[model samples]
Target chain A: MFNPTWAMTIEMVIAGVSVIGLFAALGLVLVLMERRVAAWMQIRLGPNRVGPKGMLQSLADTVKLLVKEGMTPDGSDKFLFNLAPYIAMMVAMLLMAPIAFAKDFRLWDMNIGVLYITAISSIMVISILMAGWASNNKYSLMGAMRSGAQIVSYELSAGLSILTIVVLTGSLNITDIINAQADGWWIFKGHIPVLISFVIFIIAVTAETNRAPFDLAEAESELTAGFHTEYSGMKFALFFLAEYINVFIVCAIGATLFLGGWMPFHIGNWEAFNHVMDYIPSSIWFFGKTFFLIFVIMWFRWTFPRLRIDQLLNLEWKYLLPISMFNLLLVTAIAILKWHF
Target chain B: MSGSTIIFYLLAAITLVSAVLAVTTRMIFRAAIYLLFSLIGIAGIYFWLNYEFIAAVQIVVYVGGIVVLIIFSIFLTQQAGEQLPKQKMGRQLFSALAAFCGLALVMLQLAQHEFTGTGNKAVEPTVANIGYQMLGVDDNGYALPFEVVSILLLAALIGCIVIALKSKPEKA
Candidate 1:
């Protein structure tokens, strides 16, 4: 009696396998990117020996991690300790399913795609907490607590900013949102308001994903590897994979919602130019926009120091939340006023 | 049974088992973790309903935010590595009986009732329709309730802060 559509089954299998591949590929590339970026910022050559400019360095590191033994601290909650990393990895993978990679590429084009994305993205907090509790380490616990606060606080503004996009597009589907930007992307069409919303979205997502500067949860100096302090081997790699995948998903959402999805740039009354814009393949454009945002996030990570937990909460509740709320009001006003340029 | 029905039953069993464990587990921390699993199962049910938004909210708010908060509180209490004392036998028996009776009552009520949606049919919950109704743009808008929920969330935030901040003076 068990039946699923053949197409759906095939798509699910393909998507699952591809994402696993993507996770590994992205992890390796981001590690290299991080090393190179760090080196450039500090005037040094990042890993150069491991297979030409350290291209195979991540592979070697992966093998090293695989061979290393995982430790379970005495008095740790053993069940949760093992389960936590998988939960983190699973939720992150789930978020990627709804994103419109190209014009028509997505796992599920549910009507409430935008809201769903926001909702599922936050589950990382629970996994972090589980890891912290299971680790039986004070530092890990503290890191988890800070991360919990960070995610919950930032979610308010992130939700509000996303609501602004929903209002502008008048649709919740990512595909529909992309289609709304067919003529002109929200960034250009909504003008100043879109810029404001875009900035809010970027900051809120950065906090949400626990990237650096806002990464109080895993601060190396203070928490000593933070929530994953006790984790090692492939288990630790799972958390690492989840983090980068999350970065990619959030950036893709930002690109799809604010900039055009597959739609390319063109001024009005230029049909021929716009047609040419369409030829550059949607996935390429989508990835380009997404990577640019990821680069920005990585830049923020390297440049800014971590914020104190209290300051992080205050930034969200007092500043980001209120500003995003008012920005939503402003965006609504402009949309109603038909102030498109 | 159809595939969806079979899947539903399986998921329901998992949900019920996890939920029971969540409450009945002797270890307070383990109970919390079980509660997390129970909540995730509930989200799975939401996905089955095609209310992807609600499912995600279920994960984000309940599993992610609330469970994390509860775990943090557990840590802050400094009760890690200690098993919570088991409930008294008599109390456990009474609780189990009460739960069984409650379930029986609900089943009885459900069996007797055969409510139908507007045209002798059931309405599938669609996000678009729900969103429209929420904003009061079409039909009777639930705008007031939507706004009230924000107030409810604000109260929750204040309450959490108040509870977390309240402190006994440090021991001399």
Candidate 2:
């Protein structure tokens, strides 16, 4: 006979499907948003040709990619070459599960959601390495190495910043952290030091995700599209999708930890305003905060020139790592002293 | 066995076999790929243990970090396609014997452990509990052990730096 566990298993399947659907939908929307934003920023018409306001540009691009030949480089490790994109995209999509969009709505609200995210996202470096190694190209290999080093170095600062949040919140659970921000977000509460940590978090995540300025991994001029140089079709699209998804994810986390996830902002003793703020649906607020962070990430992506590898490493080791360590000490002092707004 | 147990056993088998292959494979790149499977299997085991957090970390760290680093180093050394040099017959036989004996000793030790009165189901430790334990307040908390792990990490950090900084002799 069918059991409750079986029912739970079916529910899990549904959730998995929904997450996949969300990734595809979000990918379409984000790709369109990137084009429109880029166009607006540059004072150009952008893509009005595909559909209304270029709404279908990403769709058209998808079709183009699907129709395009999936070419493998001669003498490449064909099996791994083929497998790399799916692995990259799979890890990215897998990470979206534990993120709390609304109160009590997550795939698995593991007590270690934050840690799970940090750990899962770390795998992208592997996919990059695989793509690089299998391609049989020197540029790809170099790009992969740069990516590995960049991610490893930045991960330290990122982990440290998160540890400070964990210390202040007294919990690593995403829901608890979000709940902790109900009164006011940690950024505003923790004040200057938190702000500094937030800055470091943003920079570290941007570099960790391999976004521009820190995007030496695929330095187009130097590495010629870098690790995914040989990837094509939906495979290439997978990497593209995964990259944007990762951007959204880390920002979502930044929002959840620092920007009061589903919790709306209200100043002290403003009972009426605080009550009104509760009327807003949690999911909307969560997405609003996350998308705002996402826009800022995209803004940086378009704005900055790619960093040199040496400069990138120097930023982490010389600046970010030390600053984060110092910031952690400061936060610990402030928390222990109960000093906040 | 339940379906979960069956799947766990299958994954465990896959992991062990792939891990052996990963070490023994002559082709270094193939070995790397096999190692990926082995790590993925370990992640599955973490999931079975209900430490989804640890499982993800296993994937992100071992599958992602260490394996990727090894692969990149392999690439950097410009020896991706070449087969790894085979071990000498004597060394291979000796290592095989050592591993067999180690496995047998571990099996014997596990067999010697006695069962408790009531076979109570194990409760997975929550992240909060683990964190508290690490910070030294809980009854089960081994603060000294926690500090040792930190010291271990520090040692590894210094070791990595030393290795990275080691200078190669000038070519004649």
Candidate 3:
């Protein structure tokens, strides 16, 4: 059982470091970026006093979070209350393994990549519930309940929307999904139904990650700090980091599925433009597309007001579910008919 | 002591231990969390057996859907710190006996059988093959079962709607 080879051991260590490093970088950058974006949208100059245009503001915030005393409230369930943030963080980290970063670069390219991501992401709900209930705070419990319901229901539309692309490509492998988009992105090729599914995908994923306008889980005005109400210091920081990491990961998935994964943009019979697009590195294309989607999500956060709990469920169950289901059928027929470009 | 065998034992331990705790734990919420861990461990075993699609399906449906629902109901019916009364000694003994007998029977059957795998070939669990098998017209196709599942899900959806839609009281 202990016959681990030197190469495999080294690989595991390297991968472990990279995943943690990536999470740290993504958390720091995305949080700072969000604040700046929010400021700009509100017609105010965001934090420009920190390092160069407040670029290192997240670094300062991290230090503050680190220095603050971590506290567990009285009457809280000690074990579960402490364990919840790590559960959230671990789920997100495990999910990173199956995602394709650039061509031929992934931690683990499982056969059922999309499904694995969806499955693992669901654990976040349990962790939130744990945090909420263990805190022994009524508001925390309410927020957790809301989040659990919202995530579980929204998962249906998210899966269905993703199934639309899976129908087109005929594969669940992340790399295969990317390869299928080489000729044409799913957003453009499947025509009307595909376009509609793309919209549903974006909206569903936003809600799944608990971002606005679907962030009923953390309505600051109603429930202070939501599920992590009793958390402080590193524990709360972990939750915050997980939220941003989730945003990065979901946006990355969106980029890979709907937009082309690391493929350079190209048009039919546009040789010169395609060649120019190819000059840029594949990883840059991947990150660029991912960040663009992240910006779109952040824009939604700043623009749309928070959705009420009933309205959130109504949007998912009444609107997104049926529409995505219909779109799935259309994509199925189109795939069978060879109608997609 | 091979790598795969070791992994299997780890998964089995996780599944068994958490499953036991799920039934035995006093805290309602912790029991639900333990059940989630057990289901996830079973999903891991499915992955080890190269049933990747089935593994993911188990996770998505059981962990994602059912366990969440269970936790939701727990929140609705029970307070966070409130504990259920201990089971009666006779009932607990009966349940333990039932579980032990089931495990023993399964183990005995497994030990008695000489399972002849199809040349020990590891089937590549690809989505296209699964899709084809689901919709294929061949004898091995699962078109009937697939359709049956869809109908079953439809029924479940309708049942939930009927249960949830409460009629308004007559106006005074």
Candidate 4:
């Protein structure tokens, strides 16, 4: 039959289907949620006609995308133009493997799960570059270059912030990181330094994901649609999906690292509080923490103005990186001294 | 072929083909993409060998960091869309012959050695283990190498800052 490990193979197939379903559902709900949030911010009613409270708006959008013609710009590199969207989609899917949704539930709980995530997410930058370069347009190329510079700078602070949490937990395994916070989440447990790291992590990951005010890669006002200016229909949809999935991944990891991923709020030796928190399913708590973080990100998008390219780099290189590096040391001290409360 | 052997060969095929494509491609952009493929294929082999940490680092540093940097530079230089000039036929033939000789020599060297599988005792190296080794709390620790790398990185960063901040003189 030319097969190897039929049982594991079958399990992977099942997990693949579930992952696809989760990705689609999350995309639909987040898009709908973003619209409502945007409307609330702008004092307008958003997409309430299609379904109850515009729940089916994303579905309608999906159908429209499906029906639209997929096109390539006339002077574009045809092969890479076609390939760029898949590159983005595949990177997102690859990143999905390391996330742990519930107790003993994950695609691949590798020993270096967190590092794998940091590594795989970097591919998203390449996909953007490919799309921009292949579009054969000046604005697209400019957008892509801005993104390449932005992501490279921001990743240092992001990685350092994550390593801060890793120092506190003594492991890069996501589950191990989570379980270490059973007494209390890092934000609540590791005193002031962890709090600082958490803040830096949030800001760095916000920039890393290219959401506004850092969303200059596709900055609509200046570079109309940016790297994705030339992409239309399904290819654009893939890029959109990848972006949302990336948000979910980074937030989920943040929750896992700092918010006691799938961990309910438990105070030290507070028996009743611990019991109440434990009653909720781990998956629910997981998603709850993740969504709360996502909401925070969306709130950031609506509240802040887009940063200038220089301001963004200056924020990272000067402010975030130094602060994160200092926070890492403070955390390492807290970790060594056993000073965490 | 057995399953593991088949996988090994498949990964080898991907790595070799992509490396060749990376070298031979006319378009610089496609060459970079092919180099990405080759790096990822080698990472796949590391994953196959169960060196998960090394595999992750390989992807993070090479495919993700260096290749992206290369592509970014190409974009900056406005050379992403251009085709590289072809080498003369005589030079191409000479390089091809040299490449074959090198490959055959490496193959001969490899064939002289014996490789044993330790599948039954496969080591699942953890991040914690790496951390301990990096900190050098135990025997066979890498603390010196780690500190050296840190110093090297520090020196590089300082060099970068100095170079970037240096101003050019105005032409008279």
Off by over 4 Å in 3: A1-4, B1-5, B120-122, B135-137, B168-172
lDDT of 2 by residue, A203-277 (tens): 999999988889888889888999888888778888899998888889999999889887887555679888998
DockQ of 3: 0.60
Q: Write the per-residue lDDT of candidate 1 for residues A1-341, one digit (tens) a residue.
A: 23565555566689899988888888888788877887877788888889987889988998998898887778898899999999899988888878888877777888778878877777778888889888988998888888888888888888898888888878888888888887878888887878887888999999988888898989898889999999988789889878888888888889988888766775566899888988888888998998899888888887887888888888888998888888899989887887765
Q: Is the docking of candidate 3 incorrect, acceptable, medium or high quality?
A: medium
lDDT tens digits, residue span B1-172, model 3: 4556777999999999999999999888889889999999999999889887898899888988888889888889987777889999999999999999999999999999998868676646687777888887799699988999999999999999999999899899
Candidate 4 per-residue lDDT over residues A1-341, each given as its tens digit: 53675655677789888888988998998999889988998899889989887789999999999899999989888889889999998888898998888888888888898899998888888899999998889999999999889888888998998998888888888889888988899899988888888888889888888899999999999999999999999999999988998899999999999998888888888999899989999999999999999999999999999999999989998899888888888889988999997
Any idea how many clashes model 4 has? 0
Fnat for every candidate = 0.63, 0.57, 0.61, 0.61
The Cα local distance difference test for each model comes to 0.84, 0.85, 0.89, 0.88
How many Å off is the CA of B168 in candidate 2?
16
What does candidate 3's lDDT look like per residue over A1-341, in tens digits? 33564555677899999999999899888999999999999999998888998999999999999999999999888889999999999999988988888878999988889888888888889899899999999999988989988888888998898898888988888988888877667788779998898789889889988898888888788998789889999999999999999999989998889888897786655788888888998899999999999999999999998988988889988999999988899899999999998
Model 1 chain B lDDT-worst window of ten:
B119-128
Measured on C-alpha atoms, candidate 4 has an lDDT of: 0.88
User: Scoring each candidate complex against the real one, what DockQ results?
Assistant: 0.52, 0.52, 0.60, 0.60
Quote the RMSD, in angstroms, for model 1: 3.5
Worst 10 residues of 4 chain A by lDDT: A1-10
Q: Report residue B77 deviation for candidate 3 (angstroms).
A: 0.2
